[model samples]
Target: MPGREIINLQVGQAGNQVGESFWNALLLEHGLDQSGAYVGTNPLQTARLDVYFTEVAHTNSQSKYVPRSIQVDLEAGVCNRLKSGPLGKLFRPDTYVTGNSGAGNNWAKGFYTEGAELVDALMDATRLQTENADTLQGFQVIHSLGGGTGSGLGSLMLSKLREEYPDRMLATFSVLPSPKVSETVVEPYNAMLSIHQLLDSCDLTVCIDNEALYNITTGMLKIKQPGFSDLNGLISKVMCGVSTSLRFPGQLNGDLRKFCTNLIPFPRLHFLMPSYAPFHDARTQAWQGTSIPELTAALFDRKNLLVACDPRFGRYLTATAIFRGKIASREAEYAVHDLQKRNSHNFVEWIPDNISVSLVSVPPVGQKQAAIALANSTSIQEVFQRSLEGFSAMFKRRAFLHWYTEEGMDVMEFSEAESNTKDLIAEYQQYQEASADVDYEEEQEEQEEEGQAFEEEQQLI
Candidate 1:
């Protein structure tokens, strides 16, 4: 609230069960009252609906297994929007505003053919709202980056928002899929492109890896249930961590005067590492006996390392193994060397040996409400725990390409023949020309040789 300013923007597909759960959890965490929600742009009526969406899904695509529609209310409160049951399910504000269909219409860019004037009106409303809010209370904006909803339409909306407020700081928290199981192909690539566009537009970008968190927490509980619960919990914890970081008496300052003082710099990177319980390999089962060498190979990085655990023995055992293994490895040595090299282009700097290490034990919250409860820790735990929490959060946010060009220096370029989209389309034309040229050359050579042979034979006769 003192110096930080947060603007929240969420976009994506309009309807889905997972979306619903996520929105519900987020609203409860924010302490927003959502009793009366109403759709459309009538702010006068606090009638039982909060979310205001723009697009409505009428004709269902046969290829799609899920159905959804999003409408943006001409007048809808933030609290009202998140409270909407339908809006909670897969509705992403970021995607809805910034996505382009590769064709003509960037519907997600906040302007439809019919609603061309909605752009000016929306900006005016946003400006007014910010002025109304107490500047002392910093803000936060949340949204999704994916295909269909998040990747497509949501990205378009984000672009429009940036145009309106070039100076305002925008912190976007993006959720990334697990590398092992990237079921959604188009979304990943599309989302990456969208993030690349947003990187220049936003101030800070935070990443949340749903897969990594889900895998870790599930292993911790040894539960065989669906992963939706784990995802929700992770989201909650992330949001709570965000809320705590934004507030005073926050987690970043471990030793503080009881009353609180100056603000701490927000985290630069956050990674959410789930437990190493389900060893991707069989070798990690013995915990202590687990090869530190292998772990070092796996986790070593040039950048600063911050490790957090539950402070309990079981969780500590896994966290310690990972840290020790990472601290001792060839990769670690290389990382240190690279850091010391002045001209090194390495992105992650090596950990300094002389620097004093800081440790913070994360406070576990209730099963259902743990995610939101990250805000309730003491100053000591909050600094390390919250900072580490933010550090791990980096893995989840994603940046994508804003524009594509095969001819770029970094991209592999192909000749016309190699670049053909439909091989048949270009192949037939190539063959036709090639065959004609070959026939003409063969005939000319044959005629010349025959004439020479005839002359020689005649002379001999």
Candidate 2:
């Protein structure tokens, strides 16, 4: 069978930038250049580039491969850069869709007015790309929640995709606003609004925190001054790591559907916490050890986690670890078992074997061994709580209310988003405090019933 094709939708400025990094990484892994010419000799590795690339047969034996993705932005600047960049020829001309004006840091304008106007054109581009796929599996959208176009327009795009292709897996790589950082004053409002919509429409949303990225780059990567490119590089690697099973053959191969089924027990609780391991300073990577246990431990470390939340406070319902490189399966299994044994309290007791391991033989372009982890941990609610606090603070004074209101947004929308966010946080709290050991409670009820029967027998005697 042909590979399950995944159509990527990179929305807005941040999305396009991250998308550029992701495609560039893929080019290196598959032994292809910026122009999409397959130059690598590792037939085992480049065999399944079809998962994300479409082939163009030429008169000669050589063929060109173009990515099966579309780039969408409200303004023309970001998309233009991708088109003129080194990898310009790798994407089809129609995949770059942009609007004439910007969203002006207003979520309402992106969702209701400017974004709605451009949605038809972008969806048309998406439809054209999907037609070229043999078995289109689903869509993965990458965008940031702190800005207008990425937050508002990205939310709109997800809802539209859900309406049309309800069966396909709709996953998102959402760069959520950080509690410590404030890019725009209305970021909290925009993020909450996006969360409210995503709770209903998206199948899975991987929450990426900027605060965590800043911490990782400064602390682990040892970068003095981290730019957006530095942060996006990490996100792109995690993106590739998680999809390794889908793109390349693994010991326990899984498609998007299996991945979702394994991690997500309930539909409403699908926001995943992502972490990539084996983070070493570029200068010291050659000296760092790539032991299986070390890589697994790093994945669980809060410092390595992409979200700025403590897993110690929240329980992990389930987690999937994707390990890459030529590692022994037995070693991977023992490493996971030992990690779980040591930190059993952090995982939900109700779920047996919460941690699963998948091994991919093909390593990334640089490293010998690496791993990426996705956990359905309840601690991720902290992200929502931070946004809620910020949103409530601004909403109390009606800060910048006129901008959204003038875009035909109702006053009740704010209230609804606020309420929805609270309920979500409450739900996470409820599960975190839930207990599974019912032996004592059940024994007490049974003894009470037995005593009642004995009294009736005594009366008969």
Distance from true location, Cα of 135 in model 1, Å: 1.3
Q: What is the lDDT of residue 43 in candidate 2?
A: 81
Top of the candidates by lDDT: 2
> For candidate 2, lDDT tens digit of each residue in 224-282?
99998999999999999988998888866468888888899888899999999989999
TM-score of model 2 relative to the true fold?
Answer: 0.95
Tens digits of per-residue lDDT for model 1, 165-282: 5545454445544344354533434344444444445444444444445554555434556366555545544443333323222223222111022211122211122222112322
TM-score of 1: 0.42
Q: Candidate 1: which stretches are off by over 4 Å?
A: 1-5, 14-125, 136-139, 178-183, 227-229, 251-461
